[model samples]
Target chain A: EPEVTQTPSHQVTQMGQEVILRCVPISNHLYFYWYRQILGQKVEFLVSFYNNEISEKSEIFDDQFSVERPDGSNFTLKIRSTKLEDSAMYFCASSDLGYGYTFGSGTRLTVV
Target chain B: SQKIEQNSEALNIQEGKTATLTCNYTNYSPAYLQWYRQDPGRGPVFLLLIRENEKEKRKERLKVTFDTTLKQSLFHITASQPADSATYLCALVTAGANSKLTFGKGITLSVRP
Candidate 1:
């Protein structure tokens, strides 16, 4: 089965630094999404991308955060001025039309 | 406020028995609901999805029932095995075509051999 791939399985960064999480979605998928799960918390939606633009985003996706489909297959989430609270497991997902999403293993972002 | 609730308590069941999980939602009209399995330190893997109009759906030994009136969905794994031990997350797709999934804090199921 094809799977979404996320790079940097684990990353540690200093607070106030800029960090970018990278993901490569499935080739045929049309929709891509970014979600984060804080320890012991529910997975929260961050943003959804389609047709090379953001279609939807949650309140947690603020000015400090941005997502881009830099290439045909690569989707990225960049956080500027990371805070301690930014530490979480970030997952990238993709899906066709309205089907169930295929999620990546996730990137564990730890801000010190 | 939109909320998806799954039992926070861990469920322990003997092998070969049926394991049932519940998911309930409030304050949101979802086009479809989905279930995903996640192991420790990993992301969720899609298991099944049931639309609002569909009452029930099944795949292999797994079954899912959706009751839009009740605003709930039930996931069941039959003849469970130790390999079935994992956290199951229930999520709702809120947007129309390009759906945005909102997930619940998953419920852990421990199937002992």
Candidate 2:
């Protein structure tokens, strides 16, 4: 089965530095999403992308966060300036038809 | 505001017994509800989905029941084994064609052999 792939399974960055998390969704999927889970917390929705544009975003997706589909196969999330709270497990997910969503193994972001 | 709630506490059950988990929501109309399993340090894996119009959905030993009127969903695993132990999450998809999902904190299940 085809799966979503993400680069840099784990990352450690300075508190004020910028970080980019890359993901390659399923080739045929039209909708893509990013979600994060803090330690011992619920999975929170960040943003959804479709047609190379943001379709929906939650309140937690503030000015520091941006998503881009720079190419046909690559979808990336950029954080302009990282905060300690930004440290979490970020998951990229995709769905071809809306039946079910498949998630990548996730990128663990650690900001010190 | 929309809110999703799960047991938060871990559930312990014996092998070959049935385990039932509950999920409740408030202040949102969800078109569908989904269940997922997550192991330690891994992303969630989809298990089952139950639509708002449907009362129950089943896959092998797993069963899910949705009650839109009560704003709750129940997940049941029958004849469960130690392999079935994991954190289970319930997600709610709002009313739209391609809306985003909101997830609960999840409940951990421990099956003892």
Task: Please report the candidate that would top lDDT against the real structure.
Answer: 1
Give the best candidate by DockQ: 1
Which candidate number maximizes TM-score?
Answer: 1
Model 1: CAPRI class? high
lDDT tens digits by residue: candidate 2, A3-110: 999888999999989999999999988999999999988889999999889988988899999999987999999999999999999999998644678999999999
For each candidate, give its TM-score against the true structure.
0.97, 0.97
* Per-residue lDDT of candidate 1, residues B28-95 (tens digit): 89889999999999999999999889999999999999998999999999999999999999999875
Native A-B interface contacts kept, per candidate: 0.82, 0.72
Cand 1, B chain, TM: 0.96
Q: How high is the DockQ of candidate 2?
A: 0.76
> What does candidate 2's lDDT look like per residue over B71-91, in tens digits?
999999999999999999999
